[model samples]
Target: MLDLTTHWAGILSVIIFLSAYVLVVFEEVTHLRKSKPVMLAAGLIWMLIGIAYTVAGHGHETREFAAHIIEEYGELFLFLLVAITYVNTLEERRGFQVLRAKLVGLGLGYRGLFVLTGALAFVLSGILDNLTTALVMGTVILALGSESKRFVTLGCISVVVASNAGGAFTPFGDITTLMVWQKGKLEFLDFFAIFLPSLVNWLVPAGIMYFAVPQGRPTPQHERVRAKPGTLGVAVLFALTIVTAVSFKNFLHLPPALGMMLGLGYLQIWAYFLKRNGARRSDEDMVLDSFSQIQRVEWDTLLFFFGIIFAVGGLGVMGYLALASELLYADLGPTYANIIVGALSAVVDNIPLMFAVLTMDPDMSHGQWLLITLTCGVGGSMLSIGSAAGVALMGQAKDGYTFLSHLRWTWAIGLGYVAAVGTHLLVNAATF
Candidate 1:
């Protein structure tokens, strides 16, 4: 409605978005919640856009913009909602705990255990969020290797790298990949294109770190945890949910969230009967207490995304993204531009970067899209603070796996990143 392409509105949008991001990055020092600033930025950016529309006698355009955000972003929100909910349901059922217990019981020697842990993190991170995967596996490594601090430290590093690398190959593996998938830039099947590269991304550094793990076997102090009544059923249902989500997207011409929410319904029904016949009646049961699980849906994360996505959307409408597109892709060429984007992801958060790229809406081959996804996903491991996996591991194993400890291995991880990109260029050359 209004030509705010060159209007002050565009400049204002960038300022608000960046300011909010700075607060988020330093949230620890500030002792303030990152979501607070970003959420405010979203509201302010939208208000600025409304004022711009009013100035040009196009105030009605504000509603259309809001509708567009709701329709597009809402789909992503719902899809994540179902996935997160299913994961939380598993958490309630102690599926992760059970899996952790079984892993520890493998009676693996130190090097064998190291490989097992890294491999599990890689595969699980492809299905679970990388942060969660790293946290869980990092715990196992620290626990079993507690007598040997050096082994624990190196193992923590492997977990972070493996989690980040594993996340690069799947749609649900990392938030950046999810954004790429939700944007329709890459299809469900398109992710398989990078599977080998992602595997190399994990295995290369893992191979390097293998010698670091001592040759002794693990003496795990096993916990006395019992599986919940319906744990297996819920896990089966969770797997079904994932399959349904993929089916909906590939065959039904609908947002995968629709299929996932329906799967949630199946989980609910199973939960109901499990509760009806079971002896334990704790409220954490997903079916017996459905609202309880819904309440645990990481609202802070979802809200943080709400603000970030809306703010990024405002910038897209304001035209700064086009300027970026011209400078990065048009002038620099797609290959170099994408490679640089991946590099920046190490220092800067890739959430806003990927969202901005999605908003910029550049046109490129499918191969180029997968390349950026791999880069952004793996690049985050270059610094311990660069990714959720690294940051979470730092917190979980602070005694030895500090920021400096992780940084000590940056070169190796960085090499893995380069190899992954190279592999993509060679193996998926046709897509590019």
Candidate 2:
């Protein structure tokens, strides 16, 4: 590792990664696909590393490193495949619509509705995913707001904060947290330990923005749709999937992905039953077939994740992460360094940041690991481009939810970020 920095490949790796990441962050504005550059860089970085090691008379090291990368990331890629496919299965069947109707039908006043909506985003993102939670909640807000710009704008910001915050306490919440979970740095129930601070992260922003919600009843939406068969079943099975994954990892010492993939099989069986049943079904039900649901999975996101793992793995092989850990954690201290990294996640991509940190293999207590996880997971709410939930909302609520629009409320969100970090430190004092 000593000569890694002196080698030309190390410098080339850094330049390629930086250039690729710049385009990835500004991908929306540039109309350049984020996956393309990252995928290209992933290959190039590995190629450079392989070349360097071979030339240095350590060709065997290249094979070992490549295998390890594939083993770790392949598990993660499959884990997300099942999770994302489950979400798509629900969405394609309008399960989210049913959930949305339940919230909307509560008949609360505008202020009350806004509060509940934010609360729902928090809880729902933990189960259904941050991006989908934002989409469902965003649609509800826009419909409830009845074209009121203030309500739509304010609600969008709250949803983004709540979504990011809620995602921190669950394994399947955000990509960063998921990476940590899959990396074996944290266990399943360990995530729930941070639920309190995650709640605070959401509530602070929601409380601050509560005043902006308009008064009186929303313009009632037209007829709400009924929940379809298998919708409730899907929800129940997802819960079972969580339980199975946890039990397998904690007791049987099996990879949690085994449970997740099994759950997908259950969904596929149910879809097969639907296919054979002698009954008419809507187009939504038709998509319940495994083939259609699989087709709907977010391949771009999965590919982006693949590239990040490989690219960062290459840097790890070059000992770049060792340099980062020494400078940021050893020199500056883990606490402040982690907080700063978490804050940077608002502007940069958290996936690579977390991956890099894991590669560094910092010598921190579980408390410290949990702390960084909470900060990185929730910090994405500081700006619209800070998170997938925020980015998706920007696309869906195109007119009102711009990055600048989110910036206007960053003070409130930033306050929540600080408060959440403080709460984590206080509550998890034992671990530190």
Q: Against the hidden reference, what TM-scores do the models get?
A: 0.94, 0.96
Tell me, by TM-score, which candidate is best. 2
Clashes of each: 0, 0
State the lDDT of candidate 2 residue by residue for 1-432, as single tens digits: 435776899899889999999999888779988888999999999898888888878877788888988988887887888888888877766788877787777766778877877888999888878888899999888777765777888889999999989899988888778778878899888888889999998888888888877777876666478766667777777788778877877898888888888888888887876665515554444435767778888788889988888999888889888888999999999999899999999988788888888888889999989988998998889989989999999998888778888898899999999999999899988878
Those runs of model 2 whose alpha carbons end farther than 4 Å from true positions after fitting are: 278-287
lDDT of 1 by residue, 280-308 (tens): 55444333455567889977778888888
Each model's lDDT comes to: 0.82, 0.85
**Over 4 Å off in model 1, which ranges?**
1-6, 279-288
Q: Between which residue pairs do clashes occur in model 2? A: none
